[model samples]
Target: EAGVTQFPSHSVIEKGQTVTLRCDPISGHDNLYWYRRVMGKEIKFLLHFVKESKQDESGMPNNRFLAERTGGTYSTLKVQPAELEDSGVYFCASSIRTSGRAGSYEQYFGPGTRLTVT
Candidate 1:
């Protein structure tokens, strides 16, 4: 049941270099989230792991942006010197369990990785 996998979809670095974006979730999902939408704003939640710790990073959007979920399946988002507003489009969502309330479920998106920092 692999429904989330993002990589090199579109990356044009230049601002400062360093860009590592990779996300693969959908196997026994334990809840993994990392959203973004620079420019117009709206989608902004760059942290939320539930397997390899980091249950909530409080929307990380600084410190060069760095996220990882090693043994938790697959999840990586590293944006080093890359600046220029960090470009946009960098989503990696995975859902399976969220308190069982079923109020905010269905998070399986992984077709984004477009970072153009010119």
Candidate 2:
């Protein structure tokens, strides 16, 4: 089985620019998540998607960010008018669906996309 994969490995952009990051989760995984680490902060959850529907998105920072999982095959995170605070490593993770229980759903993460906003 293949692991989660993120496109563009790295990106550099000026402030107010728009950037889109893509992630392809492992085949057959139904639960996808978007996470990020900005500067000194710990890796934080951005959103969660179950198949093609958004399951949770409380961690999203502001209206400038948008996440989508069309057809539930891959996911994309877009930052419009990117700001300096958005510079960081964006991570993608996926897991199989499981009942609500501890340790039942193990997540596999991708290498991450590094975004640098100037």
Winning model by TM-score: 2
Error of 2 at 45 (Å): 0.5
Model 2, span 12-58: residue lDDT tens: 99999999999999998899999999896999999999999999999
Model 1 bad stretches (over 4 Å): 1-14, 19-29, 44-67, 73-76, 80-118
The alpha-carbon lDDT assigned to residue 32 of candidate 2 equals 96
TM-score for each of the candidates: 0.32, 0.95
Q: How many clashes in each structure? A: 0, 0
Alpha-carbon RMSD, candidate 2 = 1.3
4-40: candidate 1 lDDT, tens digit per residue: 9999899898998999999998888878899999887
Best by lDDT: 2
Query: How does candidate 2 score on lDDT?
Result: 0.94
In model 2, the Cα lDDT at residue 87 comes to 97
lDDT of 2 at 57: 100
